[model samples]
Target: MHVLELAKRRKTVRKFLPDKPPKEDILKAIKAAKEAPSGMNAQPWKFVVVDDNWLKAKIREACEREEEKFYSHTKGELIAWLNAKGFKPEKPFLSEAPYLILVFGHTKAPYWLHSTWIAVGYLLLALEELGLGTVTYTPPNPKPIKELLRVPNEWKLQTILPVGYPADPKPKYERKKLEDVVSFNEF
Candidate 1:
């Protein structure tokens, strides 16, 4: 697909088919992710792919523990804000998706503190291009998940992705006009 078409098709998948992608496609997506440009070639992205049911359950529970606390106490605009952006208070996909990807960003590597985002962008696009679906989440509380996954303390959990094929294909929201977002050379 063309870049623009791929970009247009790439959307946050909330519901996914139960079946997992073929191993070759999964590996290809990871390989595509590695092609992202990093600052000074640091390439500081580490992904932990989880498929075990027990671990998936644990991760979902930990995520919900934090999510419940946030929803119960957080009122007013914040709740609406998150809801509008498609944040599900209870993440069924974490347990139901065929694969879970934990993306970690190493802050101590070189001068690039944001190289991990490049890898994430690449991963999402690659998955979309390969007829897969993914939901990306960066929860405020990640230590519990890290401990559960046995991720080293030095690494930061940038996001948790629930990946699989979409349950349904539909046109997603359109972007705002560029005229509203751009300011030419200066803001």
Candidate 2:
């Protein structure tokens, strides 16, 4: 598909089919993510791909615990924003999706966070191109995740991604125009 068409068609999918995606496709996306440039050639990103049902359930449980707290007390603009997206404390898709990619960053370097985020961007686009749907999520409490996944203390959880085929049609969301977002050399 053309780049522009792909860009226009891609959407953030939360509801996913139970079907497992091809491993080759997942690896391709990760390869693309790793191609992203990093500071001083230091590739400081690690990913944990979870496809097991039991493990996914554990992750969902942990995420829900954090989300429950966030939803009950969070109000005003943040609540309004979340409401617009139709988000709630329950995140069943975290387990429903066949793959959960746990993104991590090295604690040694501050620039690693930015590098990892750039890599994640590449991963998103690659997955979109491959017709796999994904959404980047963050659990309020990553402590359980660290313990459950046995992630080394040196690596910090950066994001959680649920990947699978979309269960429903993708929704087209409006975007800001270039003029609305861009500035001509001055803010």
Candidate 3:
């Protein structure tokens, strides 16, 4: 798929098919993440792929609590906005999707906090090209995510992404046009 088309189709997928994607496919996503540019070439990123049922349950439990708050406890328009984006309290996709990709951004990397996010963008775009669906989540108790997954202290949980074949192709969400988002030579 062309880069532009793949990007256009990519979104936070909340529903997944029953099928699991192959390891190689998952690796392809990692490859892109690894290839992402980092500060001073430190490449301060590590990916922990979790599929164990017990572990997934724990992460899901943490996120579910967060999601519940996001829906019911969150104020006015935020709730509707979240719903429009396909985020809901019931994230059944956590169990349905076989692979839980945990992106770790290392704090030890001397200079680039933003580079970690660049790597995530690369991974997400790459996964979309591979005909898989991915949903990025901020797991509660990020410290425990590493412990639950047994990742090192140097690395921090940047985000948790669920990966699998998509259950449906959702319509593209509205986006601000480039002109609207951009300021020509200066702000």
Candidates sorted by TM-score, best first: 2, 1, 3
By TM-score, the better pick of 1 and 2 is: 2
The TM-scores, one per candidate, come to: 0.91, 0.94, 0.86
lDDT of 3 by residue, 152-181 (tens): 777888888899988756765688899988
The candidate scoring highest on lDDT is 2
Can you write out model 2's per-residue Cα lDDT over 50-154, one digit (the tens) per residue?
Answer: 999999999999989989988999989999999997789999889999999999988786589889899998898889899998888988889899999888898
- Per-residue error for 13 in candidate 1, Å, reads 0.5
Please state the error at residue 147 of candidate 2 in Å: 1.0
By summed lDDT, the worst window of 10 consecutive residues in model 2 runs over 165-174
What is the lDDT, from 0 to 100, of the residue 166 in candidate 3?
A: 84
Q: Give candidate 2 misplaced runs (Cα > 4 Å).
A: none
- Model 1 C-alpha lDDT per residue in residues 1-187, reported as the tens digit of each score: 8878898888878788878888678789989888888888988889888889899999999999998887888879988898887666798988998888899987778644467888888899999999999888876699999888788877889999898899856567688898989987798
Q: What is the lDDT, from 0 to 100, of the residue 42 in candidate 2?
A: 82
Q: Give the winner by lDDT: 1 or 3.
A: 1
